[model samples]
Target chain A: AQSVAQPEDQVNVAEGNPLTVKCTYSVSGNPYLFWYVQYPNRGLQFLLKYITGDNLVKGSYGFEAEFNKSQTSFHLKKPSALVSDSALYFCAVRDMGSGNTPLVFGKGTRLSVIA
Target chain B: SAVISQKPSRDICQRGTSLTIQCQVDSQVTMMFWYRQQPGQSLTLIATANQGSEATYESGFVIDKFPISRPNLTFSTLTVSNMSPEDSSIYLCSVVPGQGAVGYTFGSGTRLTVV
Candidate 1:
């Protein structure tokens, strides 16, 4: 079974500083990785995905993730964090073998960009 | 991108009763899925809603407990039957519009609180 791990339950970062939310995945085959954000009382919004391409995948709202294949990690990052960026971040993975497989999400990391 | 409209964004239901949540997507999709997110938790896929056939449920979820319906390519429903406080969760609907591993779009979600 494919699974993802978000080690940090909460990451506290000062606004305007760089931020990183760690994510590692385990899959039998190549992994399809994604990052999603959830605001208060809202559903998850897709940020970015790594299907097959460059190691660094850019996503919406100035977010980017590095897909490290050897390390089996897809970490979300931002150059400068904003106060509005404080939200729950989830890392998800699905097996590349099948298109119909549902994504397996990590426990989630609560990003706190303190202003 | 596919847009989904989920009905009854928030609802309070009595225990032992049932509540059905509906998701309507703007475009035709090949795959639809139902997920449950308990408070302070990530997401657990409940089932895959396949059109014109019975839904494929994940482990620890049953058809009698959470019946799903996918009447068409753009619509799906999930019902939490004989609900309890433990069943209180945010139910989300997801769709794969492109039928590929690129990504998926999610509905806003239905927050159900059993009392």
Candidate 2:
């Protein structure tokens, strides 16, 4: 079985400052990880993913995440935050060895980017 | 990436009533999933919709309570039957377009308020 963990319930950052939302995972096999953002009453938008290759992966809206194999973590990051970026973020993971398997989600992290 | 449209955006129904939520994708996808989000919470996988096959539900979810249908690769529906106030939740439909992409794309969601 695969599972994900988002340690923070909420994260707050000031505009122009860097931000980080932490995520970790537990999987029996290799991990396929992803990040998504959700606005109020709207569907979640794809952010980025870490499948293989480099530890650093860049994604939509100038966001990126680092995949640390040793730590079993995939942390979403942005150099500068925007007030409009405030939203709920989710981290998901699945076992790479499992074919067409459903993803397991973390509890979620609410981000509040203040101007 | 696939674009998904879900409706009835929201609905309030009396107890013992039923509601069906629809999801249509721009492109055909093999894997369609239904998830539920309670107030102020993360998402929980309800079931996986497959064409010609009955939906595969997760633990704690049953077909009698939540029925799903996948008439084609691009369309699916989820119905909540004999609903009660406990069934009130934000139900979302998601899809994985194909191999290579890491995360899932979601529909705007249906906010169901059962009274």
Candidate 3:
């Protein structure tokens, strides 16, 4: 079965600094990756996705992820972190072999942007 | 982009009772999915709700425990039956409007706390 792994449970970053939330996936075929954010008492929001074409996929709120095929990693990054950007982040993957297959998500990374 | 609205945003239910969470999408969608997010945990897909067909549940979830209904293309519901403390979690509804490895939009999850 395909699975995504977020090794870090939490990541602490200072305000205005660059931030990276690591994500790695294991799939039998090509992987379709995505990133989502969740604030307290709210639903998950779409951040970005990597279907094909560009390895570096940019998303909402100035977030981007680099899809590394060889390393099997799709890490979420932001150029300048904001205090409001602190939330729980999830990395998800879907196999490219079939269309109906549901996404497999990682354990999630809690980003705490300290002022 | 489809806008999804989920009802009963947060509810405290008693054990052995059931709670049915509704999901209404702004537009028609072919694939609707249900997921559970335990506190401080990643999402686990509960089932795929298909219109005019029985829901396809994932491992560790059953139709009896979590009955789902997809009466039409734009509406669906997931009910947590005979609830327990372990069933206390956020239930999310997701939909992918198109085919292929595209990203999905999620509703503002229903947070259920069983006691």
Who wins the DockQ comparison?
1
Q: What is the per-residue lDDT of model 3 for residues B1-115, given as tens digits with 9 covering 90 to 100? A: 8899999899999999999999999988888999999988899999998899999999899999999999999999999999999999999999987644276889999999999
The residue-level lDDT of candidate 3 at B84 comes to: 98
Q: What Cα-based lDDT does every candidate model obtain?
A: 0.94, 0.92, 0.93
Q: Which pairs in model 3 have colliding backbones?
A: none
Off by over 4 Å in 3: B99-101
The fraction of correct interface contacts reproduced by each prediction comes to 0.90, 0.87, 0.83
How do the residues A9-104 of candidate 3 rate in per-residue lDDT, one tens digit apiece?
A: 999999999999999999998988999999988899899999889899999999999999999999999999999999999999988876866788
Docking class for candidate 3: high
Better of 1 and 2 by TM-score: 1
Ranking by TM-score: 1, 3, 2
lDDT (C-alpha) at residue B103 in model 3 = 69
How good is model 2 by TM-score? 0.96
- Clashing residue pairs in candidate 2 are none
DockQ of 2: 0.80
Which segments of candidate 2 are over 4 A away from where they belong? B99-101
Give the Å error, residue B50, model 2. 1.1
